[model samples]
Target chain A: MSGPIDFYFDFASPYGYFAAGAIDALGARYQRTVNWHAIVLDANFQSLERIRIPSSVMRSDYIRRDVERVASFMKLPYKAPSSLGLHTELAARLFYWFNDRDPQQSRAFAQAVFKAYFVEDRNIAQLEVLQQLCCPLQMTPDDVASVAGDSATRARLKAEIDMAEARGVFGSPFFIVEGERFWGNDRLPLLERWLDAGTY
Target chain B: MSGPIDFYFDFASPYGYFAAGAIDALGARYQRTVNWHAIVLDANFQSLERIRIPSSVMRSDYIRRDVERVASFMKLPYKAPSSLGLHTELAARLFYWFNDRDPQQSRAFAQAVFKAYFVEDRNIAQLEVLQQLCCPLQMTPDDVASVAGDSATRARLKAEIDMAEARGVFGSPFFIVEGERFWGNDRLPLLERWLDAGTY
Candidate 1:
């Protein structure tokens, strides 16, 4: 039996963006299908009382260092997000909506949003920017807006966050292969090794 | 001025115990003092929602494999902790008390504790085991208990935890050399290199 790899992601997280692209490559290389579970990280943080405190100067610095470390390792161009934080809930839900229709399109949408914020330093919170992001994916701005406004989609997003919390998921770019959750993107190589072993 | 290495630690963390011993050796090797800060990991989990779950069945299966990988890489024993979970708050505070009295004694105590829990499979939570552990050091059981119970020590412990939370300490065995926090015991050599560079 081939064990499936579940990719949990949030577009706002640079790590998530990195994992989305890399996991896709890994899936192709290993002949494994990645089941994408797009999740809103903000809601998860709020539910866990994991607030982003403004006074946490060291906290921000650590994130900067981590981003640099990961980017350097991955050979990806990364600058700390210019906006304080991306409103990931809307973006994740939109990805989920698109994934339901076309998974490849969802991947493109995730990448575009990441590039919009990380590469271009654009404010993703602005609706116009999000609408503009959808154009590249051939997803109508109205359709994207419509999906973003769906109460059911929002509820599904919440369910995704709840499921992650229930499963003891603590961080983004979490990979669950055969019910085992690897919390960090750095563990992807380890996850791949496990897949190759064919033990589980 | 040689700035102190802010040692971020969680009392209940075994890796913290490992780092504590190695940090002392590193300090002696480099002629520096490590400013140890006791941080409550439970508080970090609450704030960050990063809870430690056991490795997956497959991941667990891969433990022996990875242990060998890490052991060969670091040239250190990579045994898993005996007890599934340990309460480190009291042990941490006791460590502070011991350190305040004598650094040598504290280092011995830390090493003993690590060996007991990680190597010998002893339950560190049991007072009887702790008393036996303390006996070799000639630490009066009553005095040790009193120190563990001191309100001032408890308050100081909480304050230190608060400081760690503010400083963005996410995991155990975190070392800060010249204001840089390096997470994980594996990062100690890298920390030593940075210290040698003497760039603050």
Candidate 2:
């Protein structure tokens, strides 16, 4: 591969975690650098007109089916996340901190959070639960909390999301390689090929 | 492999056209019968009140990308049709007619209409264009027009669309194999695998 792959993710999304695992394999197979960008999905929705997409029964069904399909394809275990809604700002900010320090660790943290919500059916919204989840990463609770609440870090996170929206991002696990935006995780293979062929 | 694979399709959808070509091959590979059903996409929208998915500049880009992706995956020349939206009712009615008379010919006719609209970019909405395109199928323009205009056939067609909505159809190229709804053309391989494994 002749280019870098930028992966935009949010911890609240199970699909994002699914993409993380597959993306790891992709990085190894193709000659490319993967940059993980943590984004607050709720804040992004807020900026886009407080437009809470009304959850339709049809959409819910689709999500269930899609998660099953991808899990089967990737041969990963998946269950619908128990937590329907969680304030993802803190988790997203912590992701930013991990990305700066260790990208691989950030990926592990992403998977752990997904497992907590979807597979374990735990309520990740509780701060104590989130803190307990971060314990294994060796980052102190105070350190993670302080960074997550920092006004400057929050501003930077918001700026990153604004840039993503401006670049036409509509969903989680969006991949941008050389100005081409592959909106879903399913497009990762195509992205790899495009990179390998050095075609725009 | 032991049973039939119900293929849910909408004539107006380009993805449905792409999937129609290889559905038979997939069915053969898995030793499953592909039961093709014609549906009206617009009717489903009215019943569901689906939010008009914003037409991102990315829509066209994604379509082109998917065309290439699906074509390569199926080893077919996938081209974007120039003439976009065709009155799918005529096509659907024609399909129903041919399906009852000659199943093999019906598949070919469906493929032709799909190619005319998506690949050739011809004005499929125009009767003249449809007539020109239908010539190779050995069906006369009169034959097509007669069946398409029949009130009973139209009623039957409308009923099929109504039934699809009642069954929770949200988009085109949906596959219902043993009651499992696979929504997109991308899921074809997984759909086949599930059938082969007798998981459905």
Candidate 3:
């Protein structure tokens, strides 16, 4: 009953970055395909009437520390984003635009976006920076701008986020295979075991 | 300079039970002693003005599934407690009362308490239930009743929780070794790595 591993993540989540950092390699090792879906996760939380950990709260301080510590533990380079409450919806729309055409190129764009925000400290919400990052993918500035507000891509992203919420994916880095759901990057090891033994 | 691993937990947290199930063995393998400190964790969250995940929220559904799945992954017997928001402050105070006499016996009592709530679905908040759980350690009902609200034990529990908060221990099953803090039971693997090589 195993099919492609569904990887749901949001661009603004550091843990999602960690999952994106290793999930493909892990899938390859297990001879499984990974379907990367970018979601506007906080919107999904709101739709479900769940509380988002506020950036002004004490847990935010721990989240910042945890992100750095986990990045080190995962051996991924990280610089604390100078800004919080990132407008990552634009990035999510672009992801679907690229994903619709070429999944392979979309993965590369996703990694670059993660590094641009986490490692390079770029404001992804800005149109110019995202367009510059896509230049290497052979897209002109105009092509990137077209997807920013195109009705087609906007509907696509909306449908994807809706389906994810319907499936109960309320956390970043949620994975589903054969109808078994695992949430968080920490659950990756257990997911690996499940893939290996079918049930453990 | 690695010293004993200070383990902070509250009896009500399922993740805390998972940590208790394995932390001591993990410590022994590295030639380290584990200093167990039971804390009233939600009080710390309140003092810090952080939102504790309400068990009635939408996220609570995911938490229930995750707890069951984690219990299976840890290979520990579990039965969802019929009660939520357990009055674990009483249990935390009793832990120190016995700990002052014999740390080993205190540890054994702690395990029994965890099993009573997690596996057997017994209400640990009730004094009659808790006193019976400690009977295996040769503690009579009268001796257990004495510690139920002893001012000495209440102050002792308060001091322990305050010290933990002062050191920034906000999550259950938080560990401190040589001043490096690891929160959540999932972090035990990274904590083990640090114990091995002294910094990855």
Candidate 4:
């Protein structure tokens, strides 16, 4: 049996959403398990001395165009969110809580959240918006609130970020299979090749 | 006639070396001329407020691994240069001088330089190393010296860097095919797809 693919992403990243949609099928094809971990990467950016300014003109424009083009090529549905820079703490905490109990349901929850944010252009920053996401997953408002506000869940997510940084994860949609790290969705092909061939 | 593909690179960038090897063929496939431009991207990095620490551990390690893996996957020979951060201005100037005379020879010169610096791990920063490279293209030592020390050649290379920055080029291995910008060697597939489909 192949090793599990450790997939790390920040909840607010569109690239992460895109990778989530594809990584599982990729893992299954290679006889590997895909493990998704939601992490707050603001600290990673801070370490790199990067400022998260929304309108950094040229880069922002290129990223928007790139994401759209990638979605088109992959045939994944995407729409630019109504407002940018929505905080993702609530959504991440809820994910961790679900993942702690039922890993399969948590993956479903993650897909729904990505769909809501990227495809539906819904604001995921709000609890009510996340609460609506729970309905489709057959989860209750109580379950959503229970995890969303859980101190332990929040701490676990924080610890995950620290652990990711320690493991040298600096970008979204980052993957680690059998100790080799691959960054960016663009590297998916290379990652597939790595799995197809035992080694280079 | 199709618009030329503007290929931008920093001479010292490993990824640039890899792209330099592949881009002309890519251009030919689409019936487009590949115009190679070498730029000093320090100013762009400055604009992004980037710090140029030699030992940024993780990123540097990842880049080294990425370049080697990519080279192996592409069946291209590669070796990390003996030293990092070699200045590329002299090479860029000489390239422009040759390019002004014969574009085909200039492409050959660029490949030789990439091989010398990457495969042989030669110090491209040195005049003798560059002079030796000019020999393969049947260029005289005087020709190499003339371009290496020419004020006009220096100005041209500087102008190219400025032009690249104006065109929003912030990274090496950036490509503009028919005015659509593709950044990174990883995007080469998408670029190929765009060429094949005549726009996405």
Candidate 3 TM-score over all chains jointly:
0.94
Tell me the tens digit of each residue's lDDT in model 3 across B53-124.
Answer: 554542377677778878988988888898866879888888998899999988988999999998998999
TM-score, prediction 2: 0.89
Per-residue alpha-carbon lDDT of model 2 for B104-149, expressed as tens digits?
A: 8778877887777766777666667667767888889897677777
Q: Which ten residues in a row have the lowest lDDT in candidate 4 chain A?
A: A49-58
The DockQ-derived docking category for candidate 1 is: incorrect
Off by over 4 Å in 2: A45-59, B44-60
State the lDDT at A23 in candidate 2. 81
Q: Where does candidate 3 stray beyond 4 Å?
A: A44-52, A56-59, B44-51, B57-59
List candidate 4 segments past 4 Å from native.
A43-59, B43-59
Which of candidates 1 and 4 is the stronger one according to TM-score?
4
Q: Tell me the deviation in Å of residue B6 in model 4.
A: 1.0
The C-alpha interface RMSD of every prediction is 9.0, 5.4, 2.9, 5.7
- The numbered model that scores best in TM-score is 3
In model 1, which runs have C-alpha deviations exceeding 4 angstroms?
Answer: A43-61, A150-170, A196-200, B1-6, B18-105, B118-128, B135-171, B184-200
Indicate whether candidate 1 or candidate 4 has the larger lDDT.
4
Ranking by DockQ: 3, 4, 2, 1
What is the DockQ score, from 0 to 1, of model 1? 0.11
Score every model by TM-score: 0.67, 0.89, 0.94, 0.92
